[model samples]
Target: MVSRKEVAERAGVSVATVSYVLNGKPGVSEQTRQKVHAVMSELGYKPSYAARALKIKKTNHFAVLVHYLGDPFEAGILSHIEHQARRHGYFVSFQTYHPEDEERFLQEVSGRIDGVILLGQSLMPETLNGLRSAGIPVLSIMEPMQQSEWITTVDMDWEAGMTQLIRHLAEQGHRRIGFMATGIPRHPHEQRRQAFRSAMLAEGLPCEEEDVLSGGGRLEEAKSAMKHYLASEAARTCTAWIAANDLMAVGMLSACREAGLKVPGDLSIAGSENILMSEQTEPRITVLDYPRKHIAHIAVDMLVAIIENKQPRGCKMESRLLIRGSSMHE
Candidate 1:
């Protein structure tokens, strides 16, 4: 096997310099970093995980498992997690797995890192048990499940976020509001839907069962779903639409354009998670400004605390509603 010493000699740098470069430390200059990388490639050098695990007595690494990879909101959370992990002298690895393959991935994860950050709604009890037996602490970034004592959790107050959004719209005279969502309704952290329901009910606003569309994760899926919903009988009565996320709201806007509908003139749209893309669209989308950065920071801090054996208190963040051209009439 090509060793670090050999690479260090080939690069004409000290062994310590080679170590710093390979481990992604910041002290090495870009030029030196490039030279060290070249030496590693030429020598076919690969770091031995088992040897390092035994010598350093730590992996100095963590993993983040996400179920939904395409969602921008989820991506935002992940970016923040990675930043926090790097700051704590640990590298973050991301893995996407289906429910059927979760057990296998958990097995692989056990051998790879000291801890895990889950951006999932819930994990099967069996999977939780497997992780626990492996001595891998999990920090879940959504709603807390039955194993609150066994796992660390941090989540956005989605219910309050959406409640405030509805109240804002109601104050603006949006009486005939419509709610739309696309995707399976089984996610354990689906507080946005519940909040929308409660808000509409509290205002004595009518919520038609048909107005709540399902299966809306992808752009095309939401576009098709919204188009079909518009053709349905409910569209004749409802004038405003509240999407559970910004991506779906963008799709709704596209569907409206296809049907020759003008936003905020013929219909109004609102969504959750005020991502950057939301502002780029024409007549920017009104959405619940979820604290994506704050969410990532808190979740990571909790994970680090657990890894370091430090007791972390219950941490929480707030979500706000951002009014924009898509959902307001001025």
Candidate 2:
């Protein structure tokens, strides 16, 4: 309801000064900036995002594209991304797409915003080509996209995460370990699966192909896959299993119970994305603590730099292991 003009008048400063102070721009004296803040609080004047965006011809709004919002772990990361984007004078929008509905996604995103962030979705060659043609600067998180010389990207090092998990499992005397992953075409999980295979093979262990199960990356699908996996005799042979994400691991844990197996007592389970639910369970899940907040911050920081036409040193995020009762050996 209150306007910047009223705040400026009350602060005894020009409108331009108020603008600079409100936007956290440089060139305003700290003393005057404090005075402007006091006046703003007193006047209860809030800046209009629409006005700033219109004047600057920048949306200050970015869209995050994912497959779905079913996973609470991913939802938490999205919440962090939204908070970080807002702190930098930007807002975030989200869209969920089916991996098969490629045409719908392209139709929906064209010219809708200033930039886009792709998370955990398949990087089709055509989609990347289309984005390039449209001139929309895109940054991918969690997905390992093509390392094009021109496009900028920030991704979690899944190989590093899995290597840590594999080594930990090996140390616990888990020679014949199983693995579960989503069947989606994204690169991050695929890289983790490959890393698991490579790590196990290098350790003089023949990782059984039948031990790997596909969840299709959906929670219900993961549950079904895990159920089938547990029904098999091979499930009891492996002392441990590595899941691509905590969601599938949770499903696996449920399946283990339904099959009358004890966690870590009969079978050990490890997962990625150390979400909140992981720690609360009876036998807490051991997981890879991928830095979602850091990923969001780094992506936005890169987007801002690219938007301002500033040459930024692009970045890559790293992941680490967090041990818990789910995978610990007694």
Candidate 3:
């Protein structure tokens, strides 16, 4: 039964001062803010989020569902998303997406968050339908498999970027270039593979069946896969290689070293996403840089718009290809 008036008296401040502190508004000094917080904690006065939701029908919280939080690319996207959400007066909760936990996730997030921001295809179509029926809007950072009224997607222009990369390699006199991918069926860059294929065909080069290798999407996986591939005669088909990510590209670099092949001298390698570690490597990695911050900002804005009843449109961005020390004519 403790009121703001009682906390104000205990903190030796006015009720308006208490309100400012509670709302985290300006005009409260650090000393006063701390004293007010101490008084409120002593009085066991907790603001009820549920009660506030009942009044406004908004929890001011957003849920970000991702395949894994440890991935550097996903982490970068998350940091910007959280920053944008915080600027808009919202808090974020990150949930790791698992097929077995879909139903439970739906149950857990229902009425607890204002909306969902999907870093990838985290939920099944049926689960997405459940979210739609629950009136929750979704903003997916990656391209969606299918479009829905409830889901808005913001993605980079994969075909354009891949075409540019392929053309760059071709211009560097590499006609027989191979592509390495993560191989997970639903991982975000399936489009990248498709784009690479199309770009190869457009350039009159065959993306032969044997030239496609699966690195399983991580640095170690790529290194292991490449080491095995380098053991075989099939590695002779391509003079250059394109990896789906910078980490995978780094893995290729390590594998090349293990095989005693000089990069660009023996085998040229290029990467798709330019993560920070790409620059930290020896000779560095060449990659396509998509505007991660811009995409995150747009996704959060779209979700907030949907949550507030403003219809938002989907967006497509372009990626800039950075040619570095790894790729060159064989």
Best by lDDT: 3
Q: Cα RMSD (Å) per model?
A: 15.1, 14.6, 15.2
- CA deviation > 4 Å runs, candidate 1: 1-57, 144-149
Count clashing pairs, candidate 3: 0
How accurate locally, in lDDT, is each candidate? 0.74, 0.73, 0.80
Lowest summed lDDT window (length 10), candidate 2:
126-135
Considering summed lDDT, which 10 consecutive residues are worst modelled in model 3? 46-55
The candidate maximizing TM-score is 3
Clash count, candidate 2: 0
Residue by residue across 1-330, what tens digits does model 3's lDDT show?
578799899999998998676544568787887787667667855333333334447788999988667788878889999999999999998988777887898789877888888886658754664464355677888753544534678988878888888888888888899999889887887778888899889879888988999998899999999999999977867888998877899999999988999887788888888899987777687789999999999999988877776666788999998988887521
Candidate 3: stretches off by over 4 Å? 1-56, 147-149
At residue 79, give the lDDT of candidate 3.
Answer: 94
- lDDT, ranked from best to worst: 3, 1, 2
Candidate 2: segments with Cα more than 4 A from true spot: 1-56, 98-112, 123-127, 144-147, 186-188, 218-220
- Against the true structure, candidate 3 reaches a TM-score of 0.81
